[model samples]
Target: MKQTTVSERALVLAPRGRDAMVAAAMLAEGGIEAVVCDSLASLIDGLNAGAGFVLVTEEAVATADLRPLSDWLAGQQEWSDLPFVLLTSRGGGLERNPAAARHLEVLGNVTFLERPFHPTTLISLVRSALRGRRRQYEARARLIELRESETRYATLFQTMDEGFCIIRFVDGPHGPLSDYVHVQANPAYERHAGIPNVVGQYVRQMVPDEADGWVDLYRGVLTSGEPIRFERELIATGRHLELSAFRVEPRERSEVAVVFQDVTERKRAEIALRELNETLERRIEAAVAERQAAAEQLHEAQKLETIGQLTGGVAHDVNNLLTPITGALDLLHRRSADHDPRMARLIDGALQSAERARVLVSRLLGFARRQALETRATDICSLLTGVQDLVTSSIGPSISLRVECSQDLPPALIDPNQLELAILNLSVNARDAMLEGGILTIAASHVRVDALEVSGLAAGDYVRIVVSDTGTGMSAETLARAIEPFYSTKEVGKGTGLGLSMVHGLAGQLGGAFTLTSAPGQGTQASLYLPLAPGVAAANGLSSDSTLMEMEPLNILLADDEQLVRIGTAEMLRELGHVVHEAASGAQALNRLIAGEPIDLLITDYMMPGMNGAALAGRVGEINPDLPVLVITGYAGGDLDIGLPQLTKPFRQADLARSLYRLFHTGETLPTDCA
Candidate 1:
């Protein structure tokens, strides 16, 4: 293939004189390359070999066929405009000679230099010509880069699935931005829009009926420089287009780039649904009212959730504060037998008061559903016999209490501590209703049920406990909203309204249901249904009065964030015959393990600031998997599922020893040494 590669060489043609040779010598002195040709035909051939610019004598081109030279100039690339220096006789500049004008026409960018001119002048002119040629080459390079970039963009534009176009806002007879023309569109445009060859088509021409709407919509986008997403019906084609558009950069161009998808099928479905909904207006109204009620309930739940967070935090701190007080009082009470009779009585009262504070904290935790449940198979009859005294005291002398339970009923799986709290709450509510006096009867019985027999219960045998009052009964309206959290009929200062809610939550937590039935004249009956258990209750191991059992003392590493809680717990552990080591945080505890410290057991606070007990235990597993880890927490429910045994806080010396017994003794309670 014939080709000409452009270079910075000057071509000279002066067949009749030493002009070509002289010019070549002058250019070489000026650090420019030159090629001299003997004839016009040779000059044309040199031009084919790619010269930056040509210097030809008037005599050389005045007599020869100039067609080839003219043709080469005409065939030059758009970026390339070959500069020429025409050497002529004396006084032959463009203004002085008409023939020079003919040479100017032949060489589009021609310069005239007469004979007998100074060499510097000739060099200066030639240098200027060459400088112009260099810029032309630079422009050519830029054009090549632009073309390659366009090639990549075109590939993506053609293959993209989404319909895309570049439209220019054009002013029409109506005013400014009265029309738009699709200057570019992808191949997929027709598949999506059902309009082929949209390029170079006006918006009005394609969908004249909807042109004004489309124009105004896109006009806003172009003016504000804000991208928009909308769906509009193209009325002409009856197709709905979901489109997103943004103004093209260099905003003066008034062009917008649009990406769109045809959502006609989805639009049709929506329209059909709208038509069908017209027949069910009454049902929809009912649904909306129900949803409003649910929303209100959710709003209340959100408020309670906020309160619950604050309550949980307070409970954690209170439990930590109580840890040392309870520990000191417990140790004092155990050694009280040797003290004076009056001092021993004082110690018993302080210990009892601390127990009351502990129960109060548990009640607050229950309201937030953060209290951990310890469910076991419990004899309903026995549990009621134990709690009757507590309930009787709570209701006062005005309410006469009655209790009944079937002797043959099996044990029900439940948390007796929480159940006791719920019983007190119900009895108190019944007492409030009967200001003068009333009978509060609590009865327990077993019943088998199918799914249809209960609202929320599965088909199974359940132990039902009913607390009925002979006081002024509740209206149906009051009964309906009775169990809702924080909904109270009692006057402002009388009740907290969390009692029934907590009871209901307790039943539900143990795979049971709590329901209330009442009428305006009839007294209220609150029923709690508990799932049946497989066997009799295990003797509870959490009693604080249990004596410490003798076992091998452990090299225990204790980690806690609070200094008081840590010191009190460590003292308890040390008194139980264990060698205690303390760390203020879980990270310190983990570091001890990493340093290969001897540790038989790791007792850590669950809510340490950095590297909590669970994380420390996990890291400890990598070092020594057999090491026994017990997580002790004051905060009950949050990130507590670390798959490790946990002992909650506010424990005495006996309780700490009991948890240790579980670790060292395993699956059996050790008898008190009583030494």
Candidate 2:
């Protein structure tokens, strides 16, 4: 029920002027717009302009050659068929006249009225023809609207983002449908599925792997008359697709419409996220374990530091007490040289016992004190060879010893004596572990130490000394405290527990590190890392066997706060053929030097009541720049920089004699054995 604006008036064509006017007047009076034409040419023009109905006399239609009008009628639009009302004479017999009938046929939908008909009849016939013409115009409007709707639908189907395809099932040998063919596909279908030229192709032929299950899914939707949505991977294209299918009309033949989109990237991202989460969990577990281990190491270090502090305080007191005792023993031995033979034997025994005690005290002090290192370029291979015999004899013949030294190994910068002692201590410990006897291997090699490889050591070249024992190794509990002072695993009185602690101290003081590896059942391996020495020859210590030089007696100033120590030391110097002056304090010693007491040498104790020995030495240097001074101390604390000749306390007659000899010949070149 749509409306149209096309002309709804009647057009009249009559050669007879009167009849044409009459018909026009009648149509106008009957409420119809009418147009009258005087000739066939004018009537053709009127039809072209648009008219609801045509009024023409048979004479006008036949005599005028209506060919142009017939052609116009044949070319009419599908929705239009022009209506015509014809007026003819009653006795004309137009049906029998072929030419007249043919003319009449050209004007389609014609209504005939006789010439004698009443005016009311003519008007009614014209009205009927006009109504029919209006219906034709309405049909034309509906046809145009239908075409526009179809155009819009086609545009949407082709341009939508999701792929759309219509499939019709093909029948097989056993059933109504075995496969489906692509009946219609949009532009997006190829992009989403990575398949080109898909339309009009059967699903089985295009993607054979997917045909079996995919056809079944579509068939079920068609039979059940329900829609389905799911996801699948296309084997041919390697694409993940999200698909939705619904049954189309004519479902008995198994026709379906499908919409799909590619979701491969989304699926890949989900998997990557899951893997990242798993890796993060593993890293977190490792970090937690590292923190726990670090805490345990800190606790052990704190415990060892506390015990070292207590042991250091006790060792300092012992050194002080032994100073006077050893000094008196030296004096008695000298005086008892010609005593009874039995008394001389007793003296020899007592000196041996005191020497043993001194060695034990030195080990305790090594664990407690952070002493200055006298580092020198030492050939490690040669040093190890020198100690091999001593170490083998100490371990006994039950255990075999092997020394492996690499050729061209780098020299280590360390105190030779301390390193030798450390090696000896490690060898003894190895001997004790091998109750049933085992092989002890000592090896030396040149190695490069990276910064991260060792704690508290810089990246550089080092000499690595490894000691391996095929003996019962330590348990975890014992290994953890192996470097702690006085933490012995041996039975009471069997071990001092200071062996590894002293070695650890030596390594640290020399700017290196010590590492021990052991397990309950496996053998033990200990590595001593010493930094490579700057290129230089080895520094030798003063040799005890060096003969004393003959020298003229010189005036000497001997100063000490302790009366016993001062008197005892003065007597030893006097016995060594030197004039000795005594002073109880640094102030008293300075007074004698200021008064021009003819002092040839100044020997002062480091710790005195007023002004220490270093201060006295500095004052004496101002008075006599060339005066030689010797500083003696029982315990050399952290500050030992006196810039004077140093001699450790509790010395013998020979020790004083050697020191005096060196002082008199300070300007002369002495033998290297005095180093």
Candidate 3:
């Protein structure tokens, strides 16, 4: 294909009239752009102005010196020869124009034209010369453009922080891996590789081990025609570098260009950023968990507080009903015939149901902190031993119960009854776990704990009691939520799910800690840690103390906000053949005393809307210093902050009778267990 060429600009130097006009007209007709100049001065100016070609008459050359033009043409590069056409006679080619033709052989693509008898010949010569000149001009323009592009690329490569290298291949007869040369290296590459003047050098001498790899890479590209990019660690430079090599095509020479970059800093930055992100994520997750835990604790506390309010009222009302029922039962049993046992059975059934209700309410009150606690230093070993029989009785026949009481177990100050109830609850849970056959182990020991030994436990001596079961165990997820109230593994209606919660609450009330550990197929273990009690003796055995008989009556005053409770309680007192007076509020009860009612005893209900039981007791004591007062309420300590003798709600009639007799008989002295 013949490439179309745009015409070259020509300067027509026609100093003389006829020949100048003829050359300009002929060059123009041949598609050569021609500018006509009328004088030698103008022609010289045009040449100096960088005209592509010159068409000059012989007369103009003879007139002007033309020495400047000769010097300029002599300085032309090998590929740049400004064509100068001379207008002459037919033999003009043979004439030696010394100054004009000087260095013509040294210049490339230079041509000459003889002055013509025919305009066609002149036009043809001018066209040919201009075509050659145009080609030279286009080549020069391309070279300039190439040089400019190379300069721009060089600036980029040298200024960049990354390392860059170009590997060139020399083709050979044997499999294309013969010669490897480092053709070009940017400044960054030179600085990193610690080499200079590396261009056009064999890689074997410049980079020994890298040379073989370069040869292989070049061969691979030559054979497979595939570009490869890879990362490698430069142990010497302590940097990771990425190399990208590809065929610089026309694989006849099997040339490949390689670009390298130092990626060590980027890798380090990535590692650091990942670590930072992980740390931030962990911190955020921990913060969220802490907030959630705090919120759950707050919710639990509020729930317990609400339960306490409900149970306190329930205890008062239940205890009142129990008093009347028991009093009536005691009277009926005393008077009824042995043969007519239907009434007796009826009373017994009602009492049993009432007792069960009382027990349930007591459990509720304990959970809600509405139960009075009598904490005494008691050995956990004896406590565990005492609860063994109860545990065995509660478990299924197929389940086996085992007890291991530590010989030297430390004493823990706790309410024995409450602890027994917790043990029984745990035993029941164990029995339920093993429907077929399993072993339930109850053990007690003295553990000296240090801060380093446990994460959440304090450094001190603790009485450790463990309840382990060989029943089915829970998974990690289930174990995590086992301590939550109302959370249970038992089927609905079989368990209240409050047993363990009650145990936890009682442990907290007794200043102890409770923990459960379980895993799938590993069974479950619950550990209770109670603070060691000082200066207390262990109980002798696991026997309940006999109820006291033969009590003496004393003047008693009882006050309650609820009308039914006051009436029922009063009836019990009168039935017991003791003088009793009733009041609805603390103020009213005080009025009775001030009116010289000769009250020997005072009993007040706690958690009244106004002037609670404890505060009322304090006021009554102020009036009559010798009078002994018993503050009774479902709330463990009542709303009043004052310290006094307290009885938890839902107490049996017998318990009330026993308490009253003990208090009045002891006379003006608070019971040691009341606190």
Candidate 4:
């Protein structure tokens, strides 16, 4: 402590002798507690003893090292600059020695008083030193608070996960420029950049790419003093780096602060999703196009079917007109005398040409679904034999036709005429494929299609009739479309494309399965599998004694909307020596029955205006359950879900005669001759 009259208590040191003791005594007499030290060691000891300030003799402590005392005082945290007064020697160079003056600077809060000074001067000097020391203490307190705040910020900066940076612009002697001097950085930034000691380094040293054209991004922020945020793709070594930059505001010159994050995975995922969506969109477009094409094809098929129906109706009417004309002409030829040879010859030639026209018309009606199917429980061997003869005559002498019938073939429930036509169609197709010469084989076998043999087929039985040819085989692509209607490999005018489609349609109508197998160089084979009629007595490939020509007249109820057909059919029935009644529609037929018209048979057209053939049958059954109805139409069994003995249109007088005769004479609807 330094003695002074500035306050109650003070300590003053003039020298290490009597002056120091006098000063201490004066302070004690003045009722002010104080202590004085002559040497640097005593000064430190006095300070340790709870003295607020120290009084020292500058000359006495001139040779002594003040470093230890200063260090020890500084170790007292906040009290490092406690008060002290330096008492100079009376005559020495205490105030003049340059070395001592330099060393005196070590005592930060010490005051100097000349020797021989008054008590008031020493006291005043001591009080002034204490005041200076008090000021230093207040400043030290403020410094401690600042240091704590700095420590808190440094801890946060080091521990944060995001990369943070601060930059500044320094004005040099030459010009003002921007530089990123890192004031603080986190561990994440150091690890991300693979760089150590990032703090205190310039941004140019950390990332050199930013100094290129992208520097404009940073420059804009600085010029406008605005916070800018943007993302850019950066290259770090060979790896792609997606960095986001945010420029801090309040730029002094052309400097900015930015923070960045890695978004590589997110970018890649977005790209992959975009590609997938594009691929899916393309697939959807393709599906839409395909569906549209299929719809168009279906529409075309339906239009063709409708046209066929109209053609079939016209052909039926023409056939009916031609049948009577040709028959009457043949009758006239027979009745004409042999003496009128020229007249007879002309009539004969005309009848022959009319017969050919009738056959062509019948084929046309068949294609149009107006031709009747005479179903029969028949031996397939005989039918195939018959087809072989027909094919041999029609396919020219170059093509050889053969029949390969299994020794014992089961009877199939099929139409004989349709089956023969199907065989002829196959033979013609084969002959066309061969062109020069080829062997056509019409074969039949009793096929018992068990469930295990062919999946989805019934375990009962089927009759497989195969027509194979050693002709030029079809490629896979050609074979795929071979069964489609109007598709053909033949040249124009050589053949109608309806051959195969008709065969397929007929097979389907017969409740049969048709399959075709062909390879590029291995020829073609078509197999037709028909359901075998139950309890049918197997044919021994011999002619049956009973025939349709020997049958009796059936009490036939001929129902047709066409007046010509009704009247002409009745006249034909009267010629056949049978009782015949006529009705226009199914409703009229039912009315005749209500009028008690004895009708043992109901022969009705399938298509009628008010009551269709099927609906009439159902109603007529309610009236006469014992009566057997024979359905006849231009569109019977042509994609309609109706069941009856349907006779197709364009029937001859003989055909109608034979159908009724056979039904009345024989109990079975199918003929004995094999299909």
lDDT of each: 0.85, 0.80, 0.71, 0.67
Best by lDDT: 1
Task: Tell me each candidate's TM-score.
Answer: 0.55, 0.69, 0.63, 0.57
Q: Flag regions of model 2 displaced more than 4 Å.
A: 1-32, 37-44, 52-64, 82-178, 186-194, 211-235, 238-322, 337-369, 372-416, 431-437, 443-465, 472-520, 528-542, 545-645, 648-664, 669-675
Worst 10 residues of 1 by lDDT: 537-546
Name the weakest run of 10 consecutive residues (lDDT summed) in model 3. Answer: 540-549
Model 1 regions lying over 4 Å from their true place = 1-279, 300-307, 491-493, 537-544, 637-639, 667-669, 672-675
Name model 3 segments beyond 4 Å from true.
1-166, 172-180, 193-263, 282-313, 326-360, 450-456, 475-493, 519-522, 538-557, 572-579, 586-602, 609-611, 614-629, 637-640, 649-675
Q: In what order do the candidates fall by TM-score, top score first? A: 2, 3, 4, 1
Question: Best-fitting candidate, measured by TM-score?
Answer: 2
* lDDT (tens digit, per residue) of candidate 1 on 474-514: 98788878877678999999888878978877887788988
* Deviation from truth (RMSD, Å), model 2: 6.5
Please give the distance, in angstroms, between residue 30's alpha carbon in candidate 1 and its true position after superposition: 99
Residue-wise lDDT of candidate 2 within 427-500, one digit each (tens)? 99999999999999999998888878887878988899999999899999899889887789899999988899
Clashing pairs in 1: none
lDDT of 1: 0.85
RMSD of each: 22.0, 6.5, 9.1, 9.7
| Model 2 lowest lDDT segment of ten | 539-548
